[model samples]
Target: MVGRFTRGLRVVDDSVDVFRDNPRLAILPLLSLLSIGGAFAIVLGTALRYGAVSSVLTSDLLQYAAIFVAIAVSSSVGTFFNAAVVHCAFQYFDGKETSVRGGLAAAWQVRRKIALWSVTAATLGTVLYIIDENFGALGSLARVLFDLAWGLLTFFVIPVLVLEDTKGLRPLLQESGTAFRETWGESITASLGISFVFFPVGVIGLSVLGWAYLFASGVPALLIGSAGFIVLVAAMVAAQVLGMVARTALYRYAVADEKVGPCAGRNPETIFPSD
Candidate 1:
């Protein structure tokens, strides 16, 4: 294994290069659209069946339980698939030809690790939700704290799993720590940038849909609503794909810059070392 301290510092410095060379960010939204459709279908179906739409705030025990289960499973599959796509992007950046099929295959190959990571994240989120629901005193602060901690710790989990080809809880945690310490600021910025770009698109799309719904009636309203929903789903998937592309490029840049470790004789770096 590489020196943890050195890898940490390098990751931080190289993350800028990753951001600068973020060509892959442009395509992420499209990929996200595809993935979100499948994931949200299950979620929406469960919600409708449980009457979750009528009163999400006042959902019964069974309704809440069903929603939680649906969310957890959907999130797990989405996370795994997204991570695999990121891995494929990394391979492409490294000059190894790759395809979505290859990426999906890689994702399935690491199913266990991805599932574990997804479950851990989902559990944490669920716990925070429960706490906030039951304890008004905790408020948003608790949720914020939980998210921050989780985000920082697992920022590099996907990268580590993809590049290092390592699996299991210990490796994920260790690699994530090293990657974060090395490139925390860049990682956070890249993440925020992706979110910033998507949030506006989502808001605008929903706003337009809302206005359209007011003017239309019956089937027309339903048609408009369905179209709006499709657009929203597409936008979400695109965002995810773009995010993966950016993240993959960034990680590759970091690795090539020797911020993570020795260049590993990959790509253009194999011919010339990064300064």
Candidate 2:
């Protein structure tokens, strides 16, 4: 277990190195968040202003439609940017410099696939949301399990879509699962490694907030807490980008049988040791 943890840290380090080399990879997720958030805010504001939310909630079809819209918007934006990030990672792997514009262009080239996937994912997400919201504890448990399975199955979907010619949802999903299973052990450890590195940063941020609350007051405490919050959020964003970079690295090894950047010339076992 300790060995695996140590290796996970190495994976995290490799991912961080990728980030340092192409910091613009960070911009993809930031744009995703901003686009999704802005869309939600606008939709919610318009819905509330027009008093449409209550009516939508009262009607089953309308409720599902609303849920679908929400899921589709967020998932579409996220999937697009995720593909962009993966594209940039591949560029790095190919010994080329990466840029935000290049990533966006690569992602834009596959806009149709992105749309289809967004709809499919949103449909499933809407169904899951309904089951979780209406079926009590058992439904919630089922939803959790389904979500876990879905997450694993689609683990490499972004990279597959970005790099491979596999078309249609079924083929895309199958290829993603295939790639993930090819590197299941490494995939699990990579996540653990990333968490191991970022967990301490999160704790320090929380500790700062605690200190501010206990030993400071008023404007000083507010400022301290705000700083802590920013640190926490930054850590979260960095962790997310790190996860993307790690996933891209794993995909390259698993699918392309090529390792580049910090992952080059390293044994897979040593980089992602089994517990």
RMSD of 2: 2.9
TM-score of each: 0.69, 0.88
Tell me the deviation in Å of residue 185 in model 1.
Answer: 1.9
lDDT of 1 at 170: 82
Give the Å shift of residue 8 in candidate 1: 21
Tens digit of per-residue lDDT, candidate 1, span 143-250:
888788877787667777666767678878887777666555455555565566567778777876896688888888888877777666655765666556656655
Question: Which clashing pairs does model 2 show?
Answer: none
What lDDT is obtained when candidate 1 is compared to the true structure?
A: 0.61
lDDT (CA) for every model shown?
A: 0.61, 0.86
